[model samples]
Target chain A: MTAVLTTTAMPPAATAPTALRRALPLLAAPVAFFVAFFAVPMVVVLSSSLAAGGAPSLANYARVLLDQYHWDVLAVTFRIAALTTLAVTLLGYPLAYYLVRVVSSNALRRSCVILLLLPLFTSNIVRSFGWMILLGRNGLVNDTLVGIGLLERPVRFLGTEMGIVIGLVYILLPFIVLAVGNALATVDPTLEEASADLGASPFTTFWTVTFPLCLPGLIAGVIMVFTLAASAYVTPALLSGGKITVFPMLIFQQYSTVFDVHYGGALSITLLVFTLVLVALAGRIGNGGGDRS
Target chain B: MIARVVLRIVAWAVMAYLILPLVVIVGASLTATSYLAFPPQGLTLAWYGRMLADTSYVAAFGTSTALALAATAGAVLLALPAALAIARHDFPGKRTLLSLLMSPLVLPHVVLGAALLQYCAALGLMRSFAALLVGHVVIVTPFVLRSVLPQLTPEQRALEEASADLGAGPFETFLLVVLPQIRGGLTSGAIFAFISSWINVELSIFNTTAELTTIPVKLFNYVQYTIDPVIAAVSSITIAVAAVTIVLLDLTVGLHVLSNRR
Candidate 1:
């Protein structure tokens, strides 16, 4: 996830107000800039998606929603993203826990952090290229598996969904690790110690106390990963070897080659709406779970 | 404990997975053979020399660097004052405005890129450097705002007020007091912004022409057609830049990730 689940958005809170008269000037440039470049572009996309032949119509969306091929593309994209999210969370949680709580040596921890970040800081093109090479027929992954007798021969991975999932997981794993590690670091050890002192088993204490407390971060990380995985273009484009198509690729094609702004606008808005609704639903679920705990 | 041992093993394995691709890329870049090879048949830097000889690669690198620098500088300039306004004062539509600023963080870049391509085309600036820079600035601004907002604590409000009481102008107070304290956050934020712009493809893809392509996009088109030692050399260079940037960030701002904040 080059577009990552960073500590980007903090929860808004109500604070004491001292609104200055100069606040308007401070806010003017940013508001205008965001409106002109960010907000207006989005609006234009929405309008284009809604229009057909110079009138506002649902024809573009009808083409997207009424088609089986489009549905298949959506299914493949979401399936890969879901699998990537599941794999990333499972693999990343342990590393986060180990780095945060287990490693006492500062030098080793720092080195590990650097290693984790190396891929994050690199471009998706380079990273997906690494996978393209490694997942090739004679590449390291296939070579190791065959050498170890786990496989009889090299398998086709480059054009397959498995390769895409593997690449997506690798790209997204660091986000989960960083997110969960941040959450784990902030947990009060005394609470866990108190639970153990009160005769709780380690497993019981972790399930009852620690996990719930970190659920919000876990959920946030999960949302970030899923959205990014769902909307990913570059990795799937490269790793899929043109044998697979994701939602974003469809959008890319419409705008880049087809020159169909109406159709591309519909696809863009469709992806945007789905992603936002999913995030809001996940946020609601996370909050409800937190309240119950 | 056995549990601890297993966790350590898993952690080390994951770390290895993270490093393996990078090692492969760097290793493959040096293969004396014409094709890519790991544990390279023999070490040579001929690919690096070849890549350097290609002026297109040189030009792309320059373009990417200049674009990232301009985008980052623009983000910091735009975001700092907004962060100050949001953190230091209360106003109407503040929450709405804040969400708008942060929306790009979650919004898919492909969608944004498509929108920009369409929008900029209407404005007759399609596929220009300005189009790419605006999109980059829009996306990177949120990062700087997020990082800097946390640094503008309420306790600093008193310091700022005292500066104002001493007849220090608003710009002077910002320079001497506000800037000094938030330097760490600003540095990390700017680094993140620069890297994000540097590495972006989905948005940059729409606005880039063959004459003004970024390094990532160049490597992208080249990689799709051929996987050669030269592409590996270019990728390795990007990885080296990343490693150097992270190390620099850690030394300067103390990345201090996964560490408890007391």
Candidate 2:
């Protein structure tokens, strides 16, 4: 996930009294730039979401919250996101474990990491386009399934939730792998060794020792994946093929085609608030587990 | 041992899944057919040639490259100072300020794009190069800051002090000692920043005019209506660029990020 970009290392404990004055000048430009470009735009969106006819009102929110159609869209959006998260974690944890614990050759591990990042570095459009080709009625996926007699006919994946899930999982798998792989790498083998020496079976050792230690990273990765999957615009847009819609698609439609800033603002804020709330809850749960362990 | 076997199989299968789409795009690009084909009816680079002949594709590529370059430079300039300050000094709202700077990483780009469009329109900056550049810089600056902050360790601070004690000025100490120590991080962060800006679509889509669109956005509009070899060729170009960048990064900075030694 791009959150990898913001993951902090240790900050210095404290600084000299004079260091604050020296640092103030350095902080000024970036802070001012962010306030101007980043913070203010978000404020604009928030204000628009609340404004109706020049006064702050919840009319737009009522429109969004009252409509059954919007509810259906939100359901579909979160369904795909939850399913994507589940699938990616299932598929990603094993890969991360293999890369971190099983692969002994450093060169091979490096190669695997590169392969993991290649798709990530590519645009979402290109990646979803690849699926657009493969998940077509006559695409490779259906061809292989039919060839092997698993299906009597070509299955339609395009415009289906399954197609969207496949693409989202593909797009997001690397984030979980990186997050879990880093966590797995940091687990001391001696702890597991001690577990085995204490007569715990392999399964028990993994469940009680290894997995808990890496739970924080796993939770972080899940949050990143779920937030991204829920709010994703490009993948769902390209893969949904117009027969399906997600929440971000609704926001995009309002902003791009309808140019309904007020309504669009409400929709955007709705998605943002829900995502942040879910993330905060997840963070709390994760922290609680970490503290317990 | 049996469990290990199953894990290996699943892991390898997932790896193949990860590589399959990229291979398909590259393979489809080389097809001689007018339409896309997998094992490519026949091998030909004609689509790539056609893409090159189209000046719009060329222009979009040029615009995307220039935008990414400018954004990378801007992020480095803005983030390096911020990283130094956050690492070297404690001020009021330091944690609040740090989160504010990094908030773009988690915020939805679609919302950000829409917000920028609305906000920039108020300021008369919408749908221009500057608007696109600012949005790109905002999103990518966190990459530089994240990578650079860790390099400003207490050990490095000790080195900086030593340089100052040797009668070096602040600029001289930064240039001679601090800069050399953080060079690896700076390069890695800059590369990440460049790539993020280059491959961005959602944010750039709002601020891009027909004439000033990025490659991803161009391919996006074209792909929604059509699936041709030319689009594949264009996508293949971006994938190739990604591969080259990764190889370059691995060779230069050693992208062994999963190491336990940290």
Candidate 3:
């Protein structure tokens, strides 16, 4: 398949000099675009964060580090993100596995894929607004809980961590399913079959053979979910009912209301560094898992 | 058999979880009640009518549509050339450059928004449409790059070479041969970029004024203080737009991404 595809209409292999020359012009547009907009804006933020009172200072970082409010918000953000990631992986992996390994009908699988993607394509406000209605006092969720005798009164879901978690999980689940499903689809069934033929139980065959192959996808999906959930602003803001505060909310307030660019830049940099560190750590784990496989 | 039944049940439940919020928003928007309600109190389209009557909502919608369209166009222009370079050539810092372009996908929009606000303020561009456009373009360009790059295979490169060898200039070859092959990727990428820009609140929130706002940002502001059918109406419109876009996407590019992999 690879060889046939490669030969179909392959581009002439240009000489080194010509390839470099042709590529240089093409690179100019995107390179200049990113440098002007992305890289420059980020540099601006970092510089502002580092400079205070006309000199570089640790005051901004010190403010972020020394403040209990910042720590509390960061903790809440990380806790919600971790929980969301765990829930998505726990729920997504089974659905992905069932779709890939169990489902026989192509039509059904296709429909399932569409259903998974629908939420992803929808606006965050629209999705969170739906939850707002459902989690409201007269919302279906509260009504259902009451109807089922689970609660005597409608619990306040709009202003709680649980509400944010539900919203985050809804938005992030599709990433996990798609990632895991792609991995599951590519696993060599022969490997699992051989394990079974060697007198291993079905469960044992899955654990010993199938799961290892899909670990990289699982890790990638988890990392994506965690990073996104941690950085999420709209969902948390909309669902939190002004009672819950997260890191992004602080950044928004600084920029939008306070106009404290120096402080805001520091907060933004803090979140960026934290998210990047976690992403790097997750990549390391994914790479380690891939090596073992 | 038990395991199969359990798996089916779980899959169905997950699907319901995905659809529930959208259904609720649409239902609430049609409610005759002034306040938002679920099983909606006496179905009516008054909220939608009210939404139309509000000029701010209308203006916000117009601004969002224009912004998203402009951003998506800019992204396509920037990304197409970049994808060609990355796919067809090797260069120093190529991997780093690609990562820098794509990092916006995972970078917190609040941070980007704050950065842009600070940067633009220094340049006397803050809180203007231009400021919003530049930031939106920065974030959405990566989506276009990602979708277009994978479609530019060596095979496609060969076709472009063939076009060039047939006395076609680079621009002519790109238009006649290269563009048609990657049309699917471009269209899908543009759709994704457009929607991402349209639904954006974190990035748009910084630069948006009371007079200049996107729908999502407007909704976010209103949603904090009030829960009403008008908000529901606005949310419902966005939901409908999303449904339409997804259907169009499904028709054009086939949204079923994972089913045929095996």
Candidate 4:
């Protein structure tokens, strides 16, 4: 979560003078650990991405950017991610609100939380594999649709954008629910009550007061969903049935199948940069809303 | 009344959406069909038996368990010291250092996997258990650090100081005073770290070979080529493991992550 990233980004304050010296030794291990493992690998990736067949050139980037297939893949990736974010927010916010405000039973709320987190703990492969079964022809989804006379034929759910979206929404919905639920729980009920007391209707109270307060959580969830959905490889790979492609699929293909680290590095760097940019923008929006609130 | 009804309907529908895949997987694993069938022609545990019978599945499970355990332990050891440093210290570029350590959470794992693969190949450690373990540790450390750092409050520091003043050595203070206070965080973090490593496919996929694969990666490879009850059985076992872990976490730390509690 961004909690780890944001916590790490805190500007060092020279408030505790004597303790600073005491903490120096403690810092050595983590700093060294990161430098050796995290930073060096990243540097290797960057260097590899830039170096193309023993010469530094933008040819890899040129190939990535100029390729029509890469564009289509990137388009598919972002389209699915954006749609998944929208769907999860729409579905998750209400559920979060319901859990926060409507569900009064402590046991029920706890159960819902557990249900939400169960998929998160499961492997993406397992989750997507579940969808692969359900979304296939003669799967439960098709059987139910046919039984209900909703379809003349079994709708192809596997290896489609819709299939990928469904899997992603399932995978990422918990983030939105948790984020919005936390924000909703912290909202002052009195403010909504006051709005009602001032002749506002319940809907108006929710829209004018409650919704604004939970916006940060909603935004946070959206950003997390966006970034994760964008980068997700396993779900799309499984659900896509090898017929559909996303940006991560390209990176995976390059590294795994082609064994082309240089081209794979370029693709990986592209996705990483784009994802980071989107996340940064989302953070800015969330922080801006936080300040306004 | 209409509004309330609509909200209830939407909430229930969303809940169904969330639970649908999991239900199907568990159900399919119980099917008598050689191939996966959702409404599961007839209930049977033969698939589970088949999964258990496979040596590769068993080996992958063993490897995943060992890797997750080792990675979680390494993350805790590394993160505990790091958390103390970040929470209690004031150092130049500390923020950057922290971000570098924690950036793996947001950075694409496929990218990290590729990078680590490339990096390890240079050092002659590619496709080995060591290469995989180090990658897993890097990704999982942030979980422990994030969870543990928040627990090291000024109040906790005051308690640590008190322990030190009471003739407790540094190690004794950490063991008796600091650790107990952060035990919940450490436990939750370690659980999360372990689960993250267990569920990992991206990083592990890069380092895992046919002979040395994790369960998830193995399933990933198999599911691509075949869709059978055995794969369902493997997937179901993982789902069951995940369910057990969640229940354990719920019982231990309480999974009311979004409850209206301070």
Candidate 5:
């Protein structure tokens, strides 16, 4: 299969100069487009962040970093992101494992996968709107809880951290499922079978063999969920109901309402850098896990 | 065995959790009441009718459709060549270029939106369709690139070379041989790109005006100020569109995503 694949997929061997020249025409349009639109816009934001009062200054950074309000918002944002990632991983891992390793019916698994992708494909606004109605004071969730004696009265979900986390997890859960599902699918089941036949318990086999293999995918999903939950604007905006604020919301406020590009630029860069650093750390951790066991 | 049973129960519950909100929105949209309700007070299409009666809703839908179509087309045009280059030839900065294209997937759309707003304002094109198109293209191109790159394998290259050696020109070879091979990837990628552009809020919010808003951004703005059956109706329409797209996607490409097949 590998040899067949290579023969079918690989380009004809060509000299480096000729291949570079041939590839140039194809690369030109996309490279130019990204440089103009993506790269240049990012550069503009970076420059704006570094300048204030028509001079290059760190005032915007100081304002963003030194302010207590910003720190509070960052704490809320990161906390929500961290919690969302954890919740998604907990919920998603089992579903992925069931789908990949346990489920016997192909049709069932496909339907479940479709169900997973539907919410992902749908707009966050729409999904969050759904949650808003369901979580309202007299909504079905509260009604059911009260009816079942789970609560004495309707509990507030809107305008709270828990509400934000719920919405973010719902929006992000599919990433974890897909990532870990694909990873699970690639693991050789025979290894687990061998461990079992060699007198290891199922739990021991999983912890010693199966779990380590899928760590990369789990980490990828965790990073994706974290980044997405951290930067999520629409879900947090709707679910928070103006009572909670995340980092992206602050950035949006500065640009959309305050029209303070310098401050917003600083906020944008701060969020971007923070997300990048977390992602890097997660990658390192994932690699470390891969190296161990 | 007990653990397996537990896993099964948890999986089903998670599936329900995954689907409950969408079911509620679709249900609430049919409520006869002026306010939104699930297990809807009474079934009625009146809210959907009211939505249809509004010209702004109709216009926003039209604008969103046009923008998504344009962006998808632009992404396909730009990304296909880039995919071809990356798959067919090794070049300097190939890894960097691929990451640059795909970075939008991970970058915060809010930041991108704000950056575009600032950049376009500097370029004298703020809040225009052009500005929206460029931003949408930048973001959605990666979808097309990712999907198409994997389809361009060495075996496919051999077929293309065979067509060329048989005296077919580059364009003809691409049209007949290469296009057919990557049709699945390209179609799926284009659909994904279309939907991503269509349903985008954060990115579109920055460039959109009251006159030229997309459906998702419009819905975002409306849902903030009010929660009514009409809003639910609008949400349901988008939900229906998403449902249809997914169904079409499943039928066409076979969403065997969880299959343990290599």
Candidate 6:
């Protein structure tokens, strides 16, 4: 399939590079605009990060990297992201399976999909606001817990890492469901039946066959969730109630409040590098999963 | 059988988790009390009325709508041409160019937003609508490109070539042969672009002021210090917009994202 796509997708691979001029008009506007706004601004940030007092220096990096506070913020940021990824995967996979393989009613599936997309389509602010209301000391979750005698009194959640994790998980769950559901929908069920015919139990079939087939999509969704969760500012900020701070908040404070672009630039570049490295690593993992499948 | 039953319960619980928050916001919006309340202490639409009465909320809504619309239009206009070039033609450094165009997807908005705040400040464009629109276009254009590039398959390229060979002009070939086939991609891409722009807070936060804020930014600011029924009403409005958009997308393009089509 890959070979066929590569061949047919490219007509006459040896075709002349002279055809480039024909694309000039089409590429001119988009390329120019990206260069001006996107490329130049990013370059400015990179250069500014390397400069202090009108001379290129590593002082900014020393300030950002040499500090224990920045490191602590990064650790907290990644810990929340990791936890959110785990929770979303644990919760999203079963729902995706049910939606794709179990439910036979088209109307029900459609409604499920719309409901799933409701939070996705809504703004993160609004979604986090919902959580803010629910996870408050007197909010629904607390009220239910206390009412059910599960807790002596309302435990504080709004200013804790637990609150942020729940909010981040909610914000990111849809991506996993969409990713895994689409993958599950394409898995040939006959293969599972064939595995059963070969004297495999349901658990064995799922572990040896069914699971590997969708591993690539699962990895993609996980990468997306982790990256988004790691970079997320709004959900963490809202749910943290100004008590807990993450990496992005540091960057925002530097820029929006501190007005220190040099330090802010270093923070921004740090995030960009970390995010890009993770994506690259995950791409390799996803490709390996594809080969195994 | 036990596993199946457990899976059903878990799936239903997950769906409930997803719906609970939005329902709480909507229900709270209707409370007759000044404070937000779910199961709404005496149902009323007065909060929504209050939102309308507050000119700032009204202005923020208008700004958000107009900004989203303009950004979506800009993204489509920019990305359609770029996708055409990348998919329809083979050029030097095509892969690098494509990656550059799509890098915003991975780049954090806070980073990009800060970068723009600094860059625009140097160019005297800080806190301006132009600055916001440019950042939005950079981010959302990738959506348009990703959707449209797949539609411009080799077979579709062949059709374009065939039309040109059959004495059709370039504009005619694009308008007559290309546009109709990619309309679905365009619609889905545009909707995604518009919603992304509308919901954006990180990028807009740097550029928006009290008077120039988008709806999401306004609500974000309001929610931090205060949680009122009017805030619930405003949030409920965004949820409504999301629902309407999703329904429209389902009706028009068939949101078969999880279907077995691929």
Q: Find the 10 residues in a row with the least total lDDT in model 3 chain A.
A: A1-10
TM-score of 5: 0.96
Q: Candidate 4 — which pairs collide?
A: none
**What TM-score does each model's chain B reach against the true chain B?**
0.98, 0.99, 0.97, 0.98, 0.98, 0.98
Residue B261 error, candidate 2, Å: 3.2
- Per-residue error (Å), model 5, residue A204: 2.1
lDDT of candidate 2 at residue A63, scale 0 to 100? 98
lDDT per residue (tens digit) for residues B138-161 in model 6: 999998998899898878878877
lDDT of 6 at B139: 92
TM-score of candidate 6 versus the correct structure, residues matched by position = 0.96
TM-score of chain A of each: 0.92, 0.92, 0.91, 0.91, 0.94, 0.92
Which regions of candidate 2 are displaced past 4 Å?
A: A1-20
| Residue-wise C-alpha lDDT for candidate 2, range A162-243, written one tens digit per residue | 9999999999999999999999989999999999999999889988999999998999899999999998999999998999
DockQ for each of the predicted structures, in order? 0.57, 0.57, 0.51, 0.57, 0.60, 0.58
- lDDT agreement with native, every candidate: 0.89, 0.91, 0.85, 0.87, 0.91, 0.90
Residue B127 of model 2: what lDDT? 95
Instruction: List TM-score per model, in order.
Output: 0.96, 0.96, 0.94, 0.94, 0.96, 0.96
Lowest summed lDDT window (length 10), candidate 3 chain B = B253-262
Q: What lDDT score goes with residue A255 in model 6?
A: 94
For model 3, the TM-score of its B chain against the native B chain is 0.97
Worst 10 contiguous positions by lDDT, candidate 4 chain B: B85-94
lDDT ranking of the models? 2, 5, 6, 1, 4, 3
Instruction: Supply fnat for every model shown.
Output: 0.72, 0.71, 0.66, 0.72, 0.78, 0.73
Q: What tens digits encode model 6's per-residue C-alpha lDDT throughout A1-293?
A: 23212322345543546447656677888999999999999999999999999999999999988999989998999899889999999999999999998898888999999999889999999999999999988899999999999999999999999999999999999999999999988999999999999999988998898788999889989988998999999999999988999999999999988999998999999988887787788789778767876
